[model samples]
Target chain A: EAGVAQSPRYKIIEKRQSVAFWCNPISGHATLYWYQQILGQGPKLLIQFQNNGVVDDSQLPKDRFSAERLKGVDSTLKIQPAKLEDSAVYLCASSFGRTGGKETQYFGPGTRLLVL
Target chain B: SQKIEQNSEALNIQEGKTATLTCNYTNYSPAYLQWYRQDPGRGPVFLLLIRENEKEKRKERLKVTFDTTLKQSLFHITASQPADSATYLCALGSDSWGKLQFGAGTQVVVTP
Candidate 1:
């Protein structure tokens, strides 16, 4: 089976510019997730979507970061007025069930973003 | 706040030897803990998961031991190979819906 898919494997933008990342989860998967991984660090959860509705976004920087999963199959994460600290790899992951802890998550290749 | 920590240093081991990695957490009572393998320029791949009730789980040559009393998890790779070289991440989750907190990861290098 195909794994999660993401667009624009790499991106570069200047500070204060805006950047967007896209994710298409695995077929039939019910849960989608977005994570940010800074260099030499683990991926940090940004937001989670369970079939078009948000399950959790407590870590999301609501002031500048936003994400949406309109159809429950694909999702997008956007960061406006990017800062140098925002340079990191954006990962998208998916799991089969809504009760997620037990299921294995399939991850995409990730989009590596660099802010100048 | 809950914090997860893995050894930031790299583990260098000779092929055919066993490599062990550790994950420690504080201020978190996780129901389940997971391990993932990440290579350079790539996202992490799920390796194993162990629940609080379970003491040990094994897959192939990999073994994971979870000690809730100590708030620690140990991962062992037996018969290690060069292909096993990668960063290993530890994640903790409390709720059933799977919101997770991750550690920075420990890098392992196996040399032939």
Candidate 2:
């Protein structure tokens, strides 16, 4: 059973530059999620997708951050004109079922981004 | 406003001892609570989940207790090992869709 997979284990960019991340979830998983984890803090949900449709994205920074889950299998999260504070880890997680809040989520290694 | 807090200070424990961590929240009645283990530079891995109605749950050597009255959760790792060293996070889920609010996390270092 393969877990969620992400690309570019680490990234470094200057402030105001653009960065994008990719995520490939586990097979047969219906719910996908993207979270931002700052240093010393737990991961914060940025967006959630259920079968290619966005379930929630209230915490997403609409002005600069955007994500898409096409075909409900793989997803991407992008941040443009990034700020130094955006330096953090971006994690992708997936669950086999959407049984409300009870499903266990499998996480990827995450993409660590650093904005200078 | 809702807030979730974990011990900001790290817990250092010897191997074969029990490691206990706490998670406290305010202004929110979560439907369920979850605990995760996060290694340095890696994403968190799910450990356990306890609903509001459940008082305690266990998996192998890990035990989780939820107290809705106090709005707190306790995570315990029994017979701890050096491999248990990592940051532990507690997340609260308030909605049916599984939206979660996470705490700052507590670092645990188990030395052999």
Candidate 3:
């Protein structure tokens, strides 16, 4: 079984520039998630998708950040007009959507975005 | 104002000793709490999960104790080794499906 895969392990962009991160979840996993982790902090949930439908995105910055899980397997998170404050690691994870049981999430090597 | 807090400072413990880490939260009633281990430059890996109804859960040398009334969780690694050095994160999962709130994470360093 393959683990969750992400592209561009590291990225650098200037302030006000746009950046995008992509994630390919584990096969047969029904749930996918995107999180942002600032230095010295835990990963913060940005968005969650269950079978192509968004389950939650309350912490997402609607003004600049957006994400989509197309066809329920591949997902992408984009931040337009990136700010220096957005310099942090973006993590992607996937889990089996099992009801009435604990779902353990498998994470991918995160993309480190450094905004100048 | 909901918040989950873990020790921001790194904990230094000698190998073969027990290492204990604490996670405390306020303003949230979580159905389950989870622990994850993360090394530098990598994502976190799930270690353990304890439900609200359960008082304690153990796996190998890892033990997690949850006290709902106190809103605290303690993670203990017995017979600890230098390989156990990493940042440990605590996450809260509420009744709302797929929602997990994480703390700032606590780093543990074990020296030989």
> Superposing all C-alpha atoms, what RMSD in Å does each candidate have to the true structure?
0.8, 1.0, 1.0
Question: Per-residue lDDT of B1-112 in model 2, one digit per residue for the tens?
Answer: 9999999999999999999999999999999999999998788899999999999999999999999999899999999999999999999998877777889999999998
- Compared with the true structure, the alpha-carbon lDDT of candidate 1 equals 0.93
CAPRI verdict (incorrect, acceptable, medium, high) for model 2: medium
- Once fitted onto the true fold, the runs of candidate 2 whose alpha carbons sit more than 4 angstroms away are none
Relative to the unseen true structure, what is the C-alpha lDDT of residue B89 in candidate 1, on a scale of 0 to 100? 94
Q: Write the residue-wise lDDT of candidate 3 on B1-112 in tens digits.
A: 9999999999999999999999999999989999999999999999999999999999999999999999999999999999999999999998545567889999999999
For candidate 3, write residues A1-116 as lDDT tens digits.
Answer: 88989989999999999999999999999989999999999999999998899988999999999999999999999999899999999999998866643678899999999998
Clash counts for the predictions, in order: 0, 0, 0
True contacts kept of 3: 0.57
* List of clashing residue pairs for candidate 1: none
Instruction: Tell me the deviation in Å of residue B50 in model 3.
Output: 0.3
**What value does the lDDT take at residue B93 in candidate 3?**
91
- Ranked by DockQ, the better of candidates 2 and 3 is 2
- Model 2's alpha-carbon lDDT is 0.93
